[model samples]
Target: MPDQASPAPVSTAIPPHRGGLPDPRHFDPVIFPGAEAGEVWPPTHFNFHAPWMHEAGLGFERDASGGIAVVRSFAHLRLLVDIETAHQLFDLAPGSRDFRLLRLIPAALRCVERIIPGDPMPGPLLDEEEEVPEEHHLYAATTAMVERLAGQAGEEGQALAEAMRRVPPGPGMFEAAVARCITRFGFPMATVAPLARRLQRLANAHARVLATAAAQPDYAAMEKVVLRTRQPLGADRGWVGGGLLTRAMDGLLPQISRPRRASTAILAAAEEAMRRPLPLEAPTRLILEQDGYRDRLLDISVFWRRLSAAWMTVDPDTTDRREIEALARNTLRRLSLTSLYRAPDEP
Candidate 1:
């Protein structure tokens, strides 16, 4: 017996809760469908000549000289979508009755509405609107684009300024455009895998409390999911207490951020940190291929994952119950292994 010290994987063993629930929960995990070896998260990439989150709300910061910056703002959106997907998978599985895409789709839509005020280009994406939707939720894109198309003055760069001046999308229209983006993204599945797994961990722990209420026919778990959708583990600290992921991604208000680019020294230090390796054989080496900021961002993001994992496990009180603690540790360890190595299939 090779140190049966580590317990069995929860993925394989169904929880023998033995409580009065009929039928085992059938969850065709929406997190990521396949063996865990070679999944590529395809970081926030999208179909566009220009890069921008179609209809998402996030924080931003600019420099003294003025320039564009992208922020990591999808955490909340990721979790709600993750858990909702989890709920559907566990509740409906495949071949079940019409589980009502309306149910989950609308809930996911609400997340977009609540977060994005107007479908204004998330950040600098405000311009470049070639074809305006016959009707777009965030017409600011149209306004901005029209301005740019109208043209900038010889000296004023009036086009850019004018585009920035356009009013944002109406509140009502915001949801429609974001809905379009979700349809395009096909649910935040790859992005939110970490989130879904965290929710699985949470829903499992909250079962005692939630199950009691779930037993009541009129119980409102959907609302709970709405209000309680926090960012997942290994998320930015700004996510604590309901802060937006963009706030974290934007890297603090302009007043307080470090000189990221200037410190070639820091980038080098961080880059060197990546020279080491992690366990298990993943299949993608994304860092090697990404150009410009993605490389630095990946390094920072990977470090955050490593640092947080180390800290979270130390405080056992914060961990799942003892029975599942080992499983949780094992699961997290497997994920952490990804941070150390470029997966074999990242090309």
Candidate 2:
């Protein structure tokens, strides 16, 4: 046999672990979806407008100082009735869920005429004539919708529908939507493809976690996905104990029958914990301290810890775990990827 080259030296080099997690820099850096190559996050431009508001018969008035005063509308009372019906039917969060569930608008309008009777909206949405407490209106609206839904699907089905609304119909919904936007709207594919891929990866990871949790409910595996999505590999510092994971667990407090004061305290502690610094190398810490970027560092740190705690301490058997997980995934969609490029704030 031809002389075989000497066996390649088995160089043994172990990856660094910071605070019990692998250095974030060692793995592929987590890119934010919809970001273009070389573009800085929190883009320089902030002047954006929603023409949809005008399309919906809403107009904004400017005050003496040229700031927006109030959103005024001369739309018919029928439109207001439809909106109120939709609000209750969907349990819409003010800005977030309202937009995501617009496809149900037509359904909401049809249901309104049947469920809420004739329009009486020449006055304000609130009514003091109703013999109830200050917050009774809120509950009354929600209760009416729930009762209607229960008639069709029963109470359990209504609950399941409510929980499922937090997420879209499928894992590919986001990617498909982006692809459609690019193709139909003439958006440049070159810039959007990378973002779509990143989002696809995130959606896949989330789906895997959900699938696995359905059967096994592995906290360690869930934590890995959360950390990988939130932080890059081989970074100077890594996530440690009880940070964002703790915060996410705090969100579950309302589901339990905890006292209001105790819930508030627990939430407060989670908020404080999220702001604590990550475990940094001694030299890196010294440099950051010397550079007067401590506050900026803290802000940047917030992004690194963003989704890491999402499923921590979660009970797989919790009645609303699916709902909470959907909400956590929605966070990635709603928030900007501001931490991808961490530059020190100007002093």
Candidate 3:
């Protein structure tokens, strides 16, 4: 035998489990090397376990901070724990000098398990299968989203959504008309209620201020109504009609006086009082003051009413659930990110 080749040095390196996650049913405790202790693993760089697998994959990974974090992709629910918390959570043997990859999977699953029902799959990620809605399913989802977002604000938030939900048929023509304003925006069902209530209150308050303006033009009292009207539907300030008011005031003030009197005095007064202007236009004030053109002003002021009408609007034959979900998810995300979107001060 010509120089029998020495047995090739046995390689001990283990390749990544890219074939997809191992079957949890047959999983065994995988003890990590003691030497790897205290060394941080990069994200998705599992020392032992693979990522969690679902239609979307699941698994915990070392987050950017090099600590273990379990995240539910939908709703962005996340739980972070330190080494000791992890040990306590998984009932790891004290002083074992090893980490078990299997322990983290349950942790990750628990994170997903905690998501509120009807919350969509986490987004900016691919859309997940949501329940197909019935005739008014979009409305239901919209209300559900409202409840969740409001609940996040505290008890007041919950009460607000509920109150909006129970709002009886409008007491008056204007209120009823206000309630229907958001209808043409293709906003179906209860989703329109909260927004309608918001718009209604603002419109009523605006009408009062305008009425005052047309008669004695009580800048002081009108200012108070305009200021109060700026309050948002819930704790989410962004949902308020402040932007709508400003634009309306801007248009109304310039054209308010017959000869196009510069509205600087009224505008300055509104800016001083409300921190923004009122949502009143010359025509709306004239209509409210004279009790005419109610329908015309409503048609004009319901935010993109004409644009929605002119477009090839697809009426919800059933329900465009995904669109409602996307709206809810995005709204919640923005509210969460907004510095001002916080729980109301405890009474």
Off by over 4 Å in 3: 1-84, 91-165, 168-347
> lDDT (0-100) at residue 163 of candidate 1?
26
lDDT of each: 0.27, 0.31, 0.31
Winner of 2 and 3 under lDDT? 2
Clashing pairs for model 3 are 51-58, 52-58, 52-59, 53-58, 74-122
Lowest summed lDDT across 10 adjacent residues in model 3 is found at 305-314
Model 3 lDDT tens row, 175-264: 343344334333444544554454344334334333222222112222222233223212324434535444443333332221111122
Per-model TM-score versus the true fold: 0.18, 0.20, 0.17
lDDT of each residue in 1-347, candidate 1, tens digit only: 57657776568544431222211122111121111345332112222221232334432222233221223466643222332343243344321111221122222221122322222221111111122112232242234322432352221223222323443443233234234334543444343333223322222222222221111111123222212222233253432432433333132223111222222333343233223332102202312321222333333222222122222112112222231223223323333333223332232
Model 2 TM-score?
0.20
The numbered model that scores best in TM-score is 2
lDDT of the structure predicted as candidate 3: 0.31
Candidate 1 backbone collisions, by pair:
73-246, 282-344, 283-343, 283-344, 283-345, 284-343, 284-344, 284-345, 284-346, 285-346
RMSD of each: 23.5, 26.9, 27.6
